[model samples]
Target: MNAIIDKLKMLKYVEVTASWLFANAKGRDAKTFVKSPQFASYPEPTIQITSPDCGASPATLSPEYMAGGDGRLPGLEWESVPGVKQWLLICEDVDAPLPNPICHGLYLGISKDKLSVTNSDFKPENEKSTRLNGGFYYGTNRLWIPPRPLLNHGIHRYFFDIIALSEPLDEKLAASKPTREQLAKEIDGKILGWGRWIGQCERVWK
Candidate 1:
């Protein structure tokens, strides 16, 4: 599938025309992920989320973190919020040609003491890196999935959102590999604060 998309992207006319046609269909801002019954009452992002490797919001994400490269998670740091018992990070691609932003990664069960996460947190099998220790847990999604935007789809925005929770999720709930719907039910009224950092990536036709 990727090979076919790569070939199509090489056709300049096809790339230009399709990109133009889909321009308005790039979907809503990735922040829309928070527009749920669970988060509707929370104020706009108050915490500051930043990536040491990606620099800052609107930064160009390193190629190594994209799907075609190493697919490693980037190191990220965020301001700690008072009364935060747990943290959740969810990365979404807002520019995908879909009704909703596509989730690239979702992590939960982060301990209150963990204000930042290094790329190593995603590499449990590597000898140099420890398993996602200190109570971190993967949500329904895999530990992490690199963003795989369509070639010639123009620039895509990846939003890394950190949600501060007033309570830690029950261990039993985390073990169930809760889906988005399940999570919404569980965290409703528990959100204390939110923050987001964005990185951009695109596959251009040469």
Candidate 2:
């Protein structure tokens, strides 16, 4: 039994060494062959949002709720970006049924002063109710409709984009459901930095 244990330990060490060697080789190859793009040419700085000190899980929609109708999760907050005057919130599912990704939610002109928002927090009655789907702010929509691709389509990655702008966005401009293109045009060369949080939703039903 002692001999068997010793052999297992040796095997573990060998496996770790092999993995380390492979990773080193891959790094070397990438450095040798890959011509990485400069940071200046990138669209925007990507900041990843994670749970605070207690190690909280990323915001997630309940499977039961998702299957039923409601698909919004609560408990979302982030630290203010260093030099943001205005912000844009975009939630997209990268693993859609093909063609293109699914846009779950797109919220722009978020007030920088407000940090956190809870579930059903967008209600008209709520003090922080901003704007949605153009003019009518229907509070929190209980039924978040995901683009359908039949059944068992696969896992979908939801990217919640928070963009910090150099100038404050005009309220009139944000009154309508502005396209990403339009937003980009308005904030062209004015984007200071950006951040994102990712959560995943997968089809569990057959």
Candidate 3:
């Protein structure tokens, strides 16, 4: 009976994998057959900032940041890319064990003069006080505190995205801590480049 159940599970996995491959293959083939010259043009790559190091994939529990040591927030750094008037920081957990990714944090209109910020730097009284969602201003320090009964979900990948805009945004908008939708409306076409860092985390304890 156990063997039969295992075989059924394996079959289901195979079916899902095959279906995904088939869909992806068809999409690639369709793209290749497109004759439009406009479709041939590829967009330029965006500049990226990372923690530990760019392109370095580490578990969120790594010692890179104090909070991340226990599946919390990670430390971050970035290279100075040319033509970056301003930057936006967005973090999402792709492996949320759900249909859609979960947002961890977001900061927009980061000044070019600012270099690196640690988990502690995100505290309410820190320099970015106004950037927090509410007037309370929960910076990296505060945001890292896992909710009660710590979520025991599967591995979650935190995507730290940085977008370099072509033009500087209005100072008023930056100070107000606008929603992502608000920023999208003002800076959609003005995005000159962007970058991202991905880190994984999981709650091992139930």
> How do the residues 31-150 of candidate 2 rate in per-residue lDDT, one tens digit apiece?
110012221333443554543321233444446325445544433567787777766665555554333445556666666675655455443444344453222222113214433322
RMSD of 2: 13.9
Give the per-residue lDDT digits (tens) of candidate 3, residues 21-129: 4432211112111111321322433565667532464444443332434434556777666777776676655543333444467666676655555655555544555
TM-score of 1: 0.84
- Runs in model 3 with CA error above 4 Å? 1-45, 53-55, 62-72, 126-152
The TM-score, computed over Cα atoms with residue i paired to residue i, of candidate 3 is 0.60
- Taken over the whole model, the C-alpha lDDT of each candidate is 0.78, 0.50, 0.52
Position 100, candidate 1: lDDT: 84
Error of 3 at 195 (Å): 1.3
Model 2: residue 39 alpha-carbon error in angstroms: 10
Across residues 1-206, which tens digit of lDDT does each residue of candidate 1 receive? 99988886577667567777787788577346587767777647889888888797878877898888998787899988889999888888889877888777777788899999988775544433322554566666466778766667878988888999999999767755677667878888889979989888887756
